[model samples]
Target: MSFASHHNASEKGEFDKPSRKKPMFPVNDRLRAYLKHHGREVKLPVAYRDLQRFTYSVPLKDKDGKDSLWETVVYDLKEWEFIREGLVKIYAILKTEGDLTFTKHLDVARIDYCAFGNSQPFRIRIVNKFNDNYDHYYIKIADASRVYGLELEHILSPNRITFLTHQQTLVEEHIPGIPGDIFIKTYLQDKETNRIRLAKEFVKFNERCFVRLLGDMRSYNFVVDITPDIEDFQYRIRAIDFDQQSYEGRKNLYLPQFFKENYPLVALTLEYLNKDSIEQYQTEERTMMAFRLASARYRMKELLDIMGKDNISTPEKIGQLSKELSDYHLKNPGLLRCHSMGQLVKQHLKVCLRKNLLLIPRLQSRFED
Candidate 1:
């Protein structure tokens, strides 16, 4: 399954510039109420703003001596003590539903800040005093689009996310997996790798992103969760960054396989899967998403209601996406009625899943004959 035939492996240039710099959309009252109803709202002792008071910082490196793009921040002694305690409490809330009994044995091992992202998140490492076990969590400024992305991932995707939001701070449990870029660089070329399985997973992952209108799934923005099975291994690609969820104007931005950094996986798909198989996987993904939508119908409707009224993107971007979708699905007039990204996504799900569901019975009948 060598992909040497796919010579154009540098498609990253096509996506050189996304539509625009994403403005941080505020969490309005309606969205806040939805979060509260869903139990995603909580009171945190420390906010994202409080973590910015670090007195000094030193660059952090990986085991191989490469700069990790993170800095280990240090605070004044008095401020350190207070922030450390608050961090422990925050971890408790994230991991144990605000149970304070476990705080005594936990210590804040380190606080690292990432200066690269839009959120500038602080990564907190919590270590157990008795056994020295450690885990990581993140604190970032709460953006409405990110929150919506997290909620959609929680409800629609197979992965379950644990996060809590306060006024301006968001605490999230660290999703554990090997980053996609690192995996592709190190493991994709290995002889024993399951190319078919990996390619299948990537197809489904691509479909999931497009169906939900989650944008900007560059190689680094996602991770590959590899689980060893009895006979082989299973790989699931999950998006770790959600900053571009439903915000981009270009329709292809929502599809990860279009990104040049992901060309290797795209090449693998071309080598391992046929056109029919790819469409089958995409339909399978849409069917599962439709089922999730059915189960969470009320909550999904409420969330979309709020999102429809919110201004998460510019009017021009919304108009462009709506028109693109309308033209893409020329047979379905529902797309032309969409006035916002949220509405467009809702209609997309309805039209795609309905078509797939209808095709199933006809295909079954053909097989029976």
Candidate 2:
């Protein structure tokens, strides 16, 4: 399980031949070795907890090559920030040979400072390191910055603190938002109007996310603010945690199913896929028609930008959405075996409107005389 061994040997257990093989990026291994060699140089306490057991940190250097207290902490997702008092943090998966996925880094860290935004909430500050290991993998801070911009624009970025890179560590701004479940039970259901407002926002949000290609959305990753504003006494919905976002490619629009149990709208969306490949656009537009049921304009472009795509051509969007819907059903028979996604969507709304009591009867009535 040593880094050197893994890097030197192929998966088949034979040593890689230089003539036919390319030297893999020495990112993780180099950092580990560097940290092992120079732990004392940066005055990193030897007895401290192994926050990143497999990770390594080295002192950052300036143009003049002088060691600075600042250093990048190279570690795996297995060991990011774990404990947060009230802030959310962002991190990148320093992918070497595959598509990079973004995620939140949850670790116990020393808080530096905080700020308050009336619209969003709390913002916390944290230290930043150079993250040279990430640089070695070509996962530059610029990519992270772009992704951050996308999240903010889409309103899918965590309301947490902003993450900034210093010489050796990352400084982050903290964000504060109620957990999804709590927000649902406490705020969403507090009043009929609140629930309706949330549902409207939810539908708009999903449609927007799908058309724009910001897959990997699910419940609990977001929160709703039911607390009425000082002037209007109305509720609001805000999305958070936009780490896993991409536009050029997508497994499916409903990729967030891993987190969500099942829903008719999502099932219908899946059913529209053609061959389990990228979703077709028309199918997505159709699914959106069912999802929105009433709204005509869905703001597809805005969402696409947040998803890092400049435009979703009418033809391309229709094509991808259709393909995705067709393929999704083939991949998930359970979704297709049951009622059509359209029917289920209708039932869900009825259930919501009837206060979750008439759901079964309504579903039975669809088939019964």
Candidate 3:
């Protein structure tokens, strides 16, 4: 199907789910250098390929005994010992800067592999032998698109991202939150749940994703982090999956409000937030993201330069997105000239956050190198 048709459907208040599988883009030399310069490249004791030695697997079930779309993988005895010891060390590297003094008391509790996505990550559960407490981390193949998404999330979003790349392996710390699908199913109508606050957060999240050109934020792709407030409650929606970053051509793909999976959240937004209030939250988020851009302008420039020269998407998608974005920002000539997803993102940032950039005093266009 053509992207124009997809855009038309999106305009008619419908959404088409992104492709079932997005081909993995390898981490090129330039991105590898960027990761190295930014301390995101680390040699780990275990790699993604090593963990594929699982001998057998059992379907993993949730607390309600429903299929969790994951499998508990078992390995040979010797291989298990090797992976357990290595994974414990990896956990330390991710959480405690490679500290091993607590290693003797820690053990790999289980290894669960999910074959559902492009990365097909192995979820590692690490437990402290003494306390019976466990923590989780992930190991996956390092794809360039995901790396760009992670780097952008670290720089632009309010949250801090911690991960490392080693050759074809990627390691990430667990992000704790209720999955958006589960949150909506279980918490949307709860008596104590603050609908207004959540609706406000959804507005901000929508702005964040659109401004940065991040895509595929269906309900399950993101999470809800709730915190206690003195008088009420606060909500923060965070994107958990980065597989679709900068890959789609349709502009609506980057906006969470258009996805059918997010219709409930959209209903909350429309029900609780007036048009002006929604605009206020969008501007507020863009202003904060602009501040973040200023703070990390140098690093963002480096990444954008590398990304502009990378081939993370097809030529057709690139051309379609360029035309769509150019149409969206007719006043900004740069969008018309964007030849790659990275360039579109760079210009889109300027178009969306120009007001906040002006407030930063001499911060505009400093990203040009």
Candidate 4:
């Protein structure tokens, strides 16, 4: 199949409306203090504004000469020299805690700007002169919602995220995996692909996003990581873009299985797993998330307190989601009391964990018998 067909499969059509543009939420003092205490705040030599000094840019193309929606930005010699030094120092800070021992051998390969998407991030490619090895990182405006999303992913998800926040800039280490769309188009047809394992992971991933209230996890926003085991391969679905963390009003947006582009994987779930198996996977994921919350009780409490008081979404959106959640949970009084996205998340987790805890004794007795 042509790439066009694959692209068409992943793109949301008229019926599958795209998510609305979410405004960037500023990081307030309380959130900043929390980030500082958690070692996520660091001073950077270059702010995001400094990268805007590019004099010209050329359209970056893929191997097939298709426009990549990225521009390879060019800077004047003097400006390049200054920015290059700062970026190198920033990389050192991100990768080696500012050791700078290997800075001399590194060179800035290319700086590409993506105009699309909420963050409008600048992608930096760094190359090693000696070994010709290369890596990439992203610099974006520091939206408070995205920062909170990254922090939650770090603490709760099976995957660990590395990111640093400066004044108005956020730096994130690149996550390595096949884009979910590409994986569905290409790897799904491979002979050795484990459809059942992939479906199970997607189920767990869906549960994780819903429990955490992370939204807009369309196929393109996530990546599928494949690891080889002794007997077979394993798959993990990780969210790469976190721009919609608890910001949207629709509850379905937080559940990946609801997206049209994810229909192939959803189909796989139906073919491989029965209803009992699906519920079992969901419970397993919820139990794990509850354990993570208990493990990081103090940190989670502080973050939620700050986020509950912050205005990350419109008041109308907060009201809509609170009502939806309350209705879904049979008008739980705790959910009805939530006035902010953060409070809604906290209440949802509380009820979910309480329900799961009640199931534990019955589950344990069955196992013992």
lDDT of 4 by residue, 43-146 (tens): 99999999999999999998889998899999999899889999989999999999999999999999999988999999999999999999999999999999
Local accuracy of candidate 3 as per-residue lDDT tens digits, 132-191 = 999899999999999999999999999999999899999998989999999999999999
Model 2, 88-156: lDDT tens digits are 222221121112232232332332111111111112233223332211111112123233333333332
Could you give candidate 1's per-residue lDDT for residues 1-369 as a string of tens digits? 122323343532544346546778889999999999998999999989989999999999999999999999999998988899999999998888889997999999999999887778999999999999999999998998899899889888989999999998888889999999999999999887899999999989988988889998989999999999978999999999988888987777787877778888988999899878888888788888867766686788889888888878887888888777777777467787788888877777766666554455443342221
How much lDDT does each candidate structure score?
Answer: 0.84, 0.32, 0.88, 0.85
Candidate 1 differs from the real structure by a C-alpha RMSD in angstroms, to one decimal, of 4.6
Candidate order by lDDT, decreasing, is: 3, 4, 1, 2
Q: Which candidate, 1 or 2, has the higher lDDT?
A: 1
Prediction-by-prediction clash tally: 1, 52, 0, 0
Off by over 4 Å in 2: 1-163, 166-172, 227-233, 247-369
lDDT top scorer? 3
Mark the 10 consecutive residues where model 2 has the least summed lDDT. Answer: 112-121
Which residue pairs clash within candidate 1?
12-260
| Candidate 2 lDDT for residue 338 | 20
- Listed in order, each prediction's TM-score against the native is 0.92, 0.33, 0.95, 0.92
Worst 10-residue lDDT window for candidate 1 reads 1-10
Query: Candidate 3: TM-score?
Result: 0.95
